[model samples]
Target: MDTILIVNPKGGSGKTTLVTNLAGYLARQGEMVNLIDTDKQKSSIAWLKHRSPHLPTIFSTHTHNFANFSVKPSWSIIDTPAGLNEEILKKLLKKVDLVIVPIQPSFFDFQATQSFLEILNTKKPIRKGQTSVALVGMRVHPRTITAQQLEDFLKRQGFPIFTYIHDAQIYLQMASKGFTLFDLSPAKAKTHIEQWQPITEWIQNAHKI
Candidate 1:
């Protein structure tokens, strides 16, 4: 199974949003997926509970059984908590196949995200490129100055910005309705679904490298 950890030491960085949507995408494609919520808010857990029966299922796992050696799925998406420290990060990395860090266009998000990258940089595996990692820009407008700054920031870190999700109400609306962009007809969600193509494709190909 391929494991992905969605992390950002700062809250409201859309970690849960990435987790739920990515899990939904994999499941809709006929892959058995698991969603593990390590956040105290249990937002991912709640999202799965609210998920519609018609949509592809996202099996939820508890914290206690998170490191299970036997149970496996095609993909395992983990939603991490804010203010995660280096020690916990190292522990989590030991089990994950890839890491995704989300950033918003703000100082708070930038500061913490940069520091988080520093932590990852120190890891032997990260330095060796043994761990596949990517950066994501969340709720960003393509034409804004903030977007430019975020781009520069990510570029400086030497990490690829897989894809960006624009600031739109559809994400929130889908969350409330127990749905995701993948749950909607392509004719209606083509734009949003297109934004995720690169990220999903990257994950699918990571196993080969």
Candidate 2:
């Protein structure tokens, strides 16, 4: 199975929101998707329980032996915690196919991501094949110069940034009701839907190591 880990060492980075919505979108596309919530906050777990029964989600606080579990889903999306714990983070990275770090367009969040990068850099060379990291710009204001500057800075720094999720009230409204962009009115949710395309494409094309 393909694994995608949504990781960020800072809170309010939209990690849970990205994971749940991405999983829901993939599931709607007929892929067997399983969501693992590693965050102690259990934000995704609460969302899963309240979500429609048709959506697939599994709550797990531990992933030491996750592969041993009887999960045969096509995709596994793991939502990690805000604090950077070496042991737990290392274990998860050792098992997943891709690591996605979601961050807001701000200096603090950008600095916070360096910690995750440092940890990944320490892993063995063999781990490189099974792991890839990308930055997702969340809650960005499209018209702001700071947003564009942040994206350009990350790209210039050799960071692989897939896409930017603009600051939209629709996302908050739908999320508050435990609904994904896939469940919202198409016309009203066009922005988020467009932003999510690249992420879905990446997951679909991920190679097995």
Once fitted onto the true fold, the runs of candidate 1 whose alpha carbons sit more than 4 angstroms away are: 64-71
Leading candidate by TM-score: 1
Clashing pairs in 1: none
lDDT per model, in order? Answer: 0.85, 0.75
Whole-structure CA lDDT of model 1: 0.85
Write the residue-wise lDDT of candidate 1 on 70-104 in tens digits: 33877888888888777777877878889999999
| Superposed Cα deviation of residue 188, candidate 2 (Å) | 2.1
Cα-based TM-score, every candidate: 0.94, 0.87
Q: Model 2 over residues 1-209: C-alpha lDDT tens digits?
A: 88788988888899999988987787777777788877667788777767866554433343435344333577788887778587767666667778888888888877777666666667763245547777788998987997987787568545578999888887767665667887777897776799988887777778333
